[model samples]
Target chain A: MGGKVAVIDYGMGNLHSVASALEHVGAGEVLVTHDAAVIAEADRVVFPGVGAIRDCMAEIRRLRCDELLRSALVEQHKPVLAICVGMQALLQRSDENEGVDCLSLIDGEVRYFGNPLTDSEGTRLKVPHMGWNEVQQMKAHPLWAGIADRTRFYFVHSYYVAATDREMVAASVDYGVSADAALARDNLFAVQFHPEKSATAGLTLLKNFVNWNGQC
Target chain B: MALAKRIIPCLDVENGRVVKGVNFVDIRDAGDPVEIAQRYNDQGADEVTFLDITASHEGRDTTVHTVERIAEQVFIPLTVGGGIRSVDDIRTMLNAGADKVSINTAAIHNPELVRDAAQRFGSQCIVVAIDAKRVGDVDGQPRYEIFTHGGRKPTGIDAVAWARKMADLGAGEILLTSMDRDGTKNGFELGVTRAITDAVEIPVIASGGVGNLDHLVDGVLEGGADAVLAASIFHFGEYTVPEAKAYMAARGIEVRL
Candidate 1:
């Protein structure tokens, strides 16, 4: 039987597109639902978000998804993927929202792209760093199974994860400093960028997640 | 290490569908906005730009409903433009779930609109779009001229200088389109893209004249564009987003693939 993939829908994500992407990447079955029972039965889970981190976390908490998500990642040890704000929600805290604690899957905080770097001409680079950017792989992981180093991915976030442990970072991308792009610890894999929006390399990553053997 | 850049797919929407043409003529129907957008979203498009090409000509409000519909379906960011002549229009799109609003004709007419939008909605929500063409000057400088009114009117304004002005006005991003190379599939106007990229502090999204993946890569690497936008190849299914990204990655352009 094909493995079941559950995409958490807290009424904040683009559920249709995420489901379509997972299905396209070879997920045997994709379910976009917030029901606890369905999530508990899934072989793998995905958390996708597009809007504010504060609101997403609020919805997850409202639906009591935080506890279930923790169980899935920490106890069940099912492969989990977090996209964009979903990734930020895996952090400890976010500056965007004061005192907002993320799922704490990775030890880090999210901060805005503070103070633009001036070029030789003394012009301040723009903030919110929207558009396609390149990321350098920091270590090998199944999430990046078919991707190479220096791969470009589509990004649109203003805040990024500042993981305390450098070893947890699977990849780093240059915005001003080497910002953590993706993180991994055992079965929990989260990306600051949207793999669902990263194109083929992203699809490869999703395919890898769907096919991963649950090894760190 | 810089942050990962984004790759955006722009759809020139008329009514409720995506449309494109050569030199803005003989506009051919592309496809359903939602379907095409879903395809891009699935293929890993970082964001999508929906320009209401006919809103002004038709004397209607911006395509807020269409933007809302697309936003509801896609999880990635959505930027809505075309006929965004006033701050009210920007607010309407944002309320409908647009992450950003692109101002082209309006900003060209009233330059302060950029600043006002930035002040009201934060700079990150404002995008100034410029359609430029290369014109020969008397001094042989080969200057870039800004075009307004859906690229039919010439303002005699220097493209590079106008980009600087927009930045001064607090435009969060610049969507720079090359009128000459648009839909020609020859490639983007590298000189135009580079000039704007060098002049603007904000991210520059290179639009117009993307025929292949190499053109996309050139827009980012050689043209200095943070993101590349195209419609024809993507609408016609010539290349999927993943395929284009893979091509860019293969060419050392640093795509997400």
Candidate 2:
């Protein structure tokens, strides 16, 4: 069989939508599996999550998806894509559900976008940060291939990634705060937005990710 | 830059077909739901809302086949409503590829449905649609009451107050439709729309009574809506989505066009 694409499912996130998206992007034999061996055997792995971080981490630990993801990125050096809560889980900790510890794969923290979210002009912006917004590439990366700079992608989240290292922030978007929209370090790439629902730009990114070889 | 005020084209679907009429009378087929959704996506629609008008009466779930078809071709955010009553229903739609689901009658009947759905799914995927009309009273406050069953029955709840309650109940957004102005083409009921928008912190989608491009401008500028939703104008070929966006952008309102 050709190299398969595995989408790690810990029973959270819209696994169906992500699988459908991966299939649409011509990922070729996309498998949504909780089995570790199957995931490890795949050439590329995708870890996607949604909903609260507490429950997300609970299920991740339950199914040992955390270890699966770690090995995929650290040991195998395979191209691993983390999306939304999946991206947040890669960080050290998150201030959601009061506070929750994360995988600490990346040296960053996930924090709430505090109520009364407003731009510099003091005008209110909605939480959940719904709808499409621009993401400007911080540095060139393989995943950003074929995608233009500052292209709009669909975002639906309240918590955002705050990395201490500017070098890790591969792309940034202004959502009241200049947040890191996408992060890249070594073989790992994660984005706060839902590329699956991003329409043309989103689908194109997924296609690029499927074709991407773990490179800087 | 600030987030652009969205312009959405809603499709009223029945028996898996897009239908149009004035106040739900003498319904006429507009086009296929999947085809219409793709056309809007190509025409630069900010988002699309599909209201399955027959699901409730038939005592069935959402039109998943149609939603799946639309989701395949149209890539933007899709929100499906009508007969979305429970968490399972929400999951079914999301599984079929809808980004969000709007609950109206069910949410009003079972307010916990909103909280539960928001908790199970993320609040971002839960939208509480409140179809309302101004209840002119003799002795009490002149408040807008919530209407369900295609605006056929009016609940005694106040529209603005219920909006605040739904936002508090974990609804990520509010889809506000004015029953009085729905098919009259007079424009959105600005007073009630602004009232609900100001009352809630979440984004509010102002729906119903969009007859022209100028009405869309008014929905955002005067009504204080985060988005403007219309069907007849866009369906009847009165104005293309991009053309409407251009009209709004020329008037100094931000749009994705």
Clashing pairs for predicted structure model 2, backbone only: none
Q: Model 2, clash count?
A: 0
Q: Which stretches of candidate 2 lie over 4 Å from their true place?
A: A1-3, B59-62, B137-142
Candidate 1, residue B178: the lDDT equals 93
Which digits, one per residue and each the tens of the lDDT, describe model 1 over residues B1-257? 24434677888888887899787787999888888887888788778988888887775443766776776567666888888889888877776767788999889789999988876665667889999998876486579999976578899999999999998888888999999898799999999899889877778989999998889888978888888898888888899888887887787765544
For candidate 1, what is the DockQ-based docking class? incorrect
lDDT per residue for candidate 2 within A95-180, as digits (tens), equals 99899999999888998887988899888888878877888899999888888998888888999999978899999889899888
lDDT per residue, candidate 1, A38-113, as tens digits?
Answer: 9999999998876667778888999988887898888898888888788888888998746577877778899887
- Give residue B53's lDDT in candidate 1 (0 to 100): 83
TM-score of 1: 0.68
Top candidate, metric DockQ: 2
